[model samples]
Target: MGHDEPPQHQVVANDLRRRITNGEWEVGAKLPSRARLATEYRVGANVLQKAQERLIIEGLLEGRAGSGTYVAAPRERRRMVRARHREQRGGSPFRGDMAEIGRSGTWEAHSEARTPAPDGIALRLGIDTGELCVRTEYEFLADNQPAQLSVSWEPMSITGETPIVLPEMGPLAGLGVVERMRSIGMEVTTCVEVPRPSRASQAQANLLGIGLGDPVLVIERTYYTGEGRAVETADITVPDARWEVAYEFGIDA
Candidate 1:
């Protein structure tokens, strides 16, 4: 198409995007069929399809591999980090920690264990054949919207005896495993933090009140206890709209 022709697909995408972003079509609203959109925009079906793809990339829409596309809802954001390190090591400063969030909002917890753990989770927990890690999940809400989805793993050796590491047990009970172990006389000497790009799953969408396949920020942290023994690992999913994280650096000079 010539510059004067206007990018037909882009024009179609922008109109739909504006509607979705402006909440004209609420989240989960089914978009018009390709033929319908093409007819309305006076463009070809292929052009309409390309327009839908653009909205999907912008996180304004969700498309099933085979199903249709739908308007995407907003998601709350979350920030997670080790409280002690942030406080003592002069890292990023935060207004709150897990405790503060837990106290201020509604949250739920689920825990269970199953043999033959799921793929990489099994290896990370160091469970040999026939063994499984005790997994606990927390869905935290802020101002009534799902703010964070977090999953923590503990070897059978630790959580098995308790069935759960309940919050009532104290901060460590609900804290990152490293701090918990330290409170129990096992010092946490090492940790690993990994973050990568990922899309929100249906479960996460349900919790965050967003349409399926929304974007999410994923953080994975592993903690080591006394003598460098791997103690626990946690996978945290944060919705970008409501969450943010910061890191601070100091100059020795």
Candidate 2:
């Protein structure tokens, strides 16, 4: 093989993908057995398996417990828009986003109060490591299907004595960051997000119902007050196969 040539498994995966795109396999069509495919491709069973697994992670195929792998029906990739207006609007922005696409959005959240901040989280929130913070984990759903996951942290020094201490269990429960902060006389004026691509961990895959190592988009989002104080920071995960993120910007006139 040439030094610049793709890996054998990757070449096989590409061919399989091309064939699928060309309608060689219909949705829900079971693939030939690994042994047969390996023989046809002139590769080992391991290599063929790897190739199929690659497509599985891309949402082109699914493996059943007892049955063999089959082509998956194409999933509708919803658009998730990130913009300042989303925060400015009251209520759950996630729900609004889903409503725009005719899907109902709901979330399950668990909050732990007085949790010690790890070094990374502490730095993000501009708090000292080991300091107390309220942590909330969220699993967002659209049409009762898992859509996004987020782990959020807020410094105790900022919200410990407030009614909105627990994000989802207070007078301001279910409100967006902007309104919640406003309730405490803090005006949130800035939102910053850094998005990066990642692979799903086992836990993430189980929750999102995707293959392990599937592609995902991780957004590090921080909400800040006019004084430049970060009140909340969250790591939001969106499965790449199920969602596409779009950012909207408004130019000052």
Instruction: Report the number of the highest-TM-score candidate.
Output: 2
TM-score quality measure for candidate 2: 0.75
User: In model 2, which runs have C-alpha deviations exceeding 4 angstroms?
Assistant: 1-72
Q: What tens-digit string does per-residue lDDT give for candidate 1 at 1-253?
A: 7868768888888888887777788888988778887898898999999888777655678787677888866543455544445544321112245444553455677777653456676577565644667677888766554667888777766555552354325444444454556555657676677877688887887776554676677888777764666777779887766667544455568
Error of 1 at 59 (Å): 12
| Residue 66 lDDT (model 1) | 71
Candidate 2 clashing pairs?
A: none
lDDT for residue 178 in candidate 2, whole number 0-100: 79
Over 63-130, each residue of candidate 2 has an lDDT whose tens digit, in order, gives 98889999999988878988778876689888888887899999999999999999999998898999
The RMSD of every model to the true structure, in order and in angstroms, is: 8.7, 4.8
Report the number of the highest-lDDT candidate: 2
Candidate 1 to truth, TM: 0.57
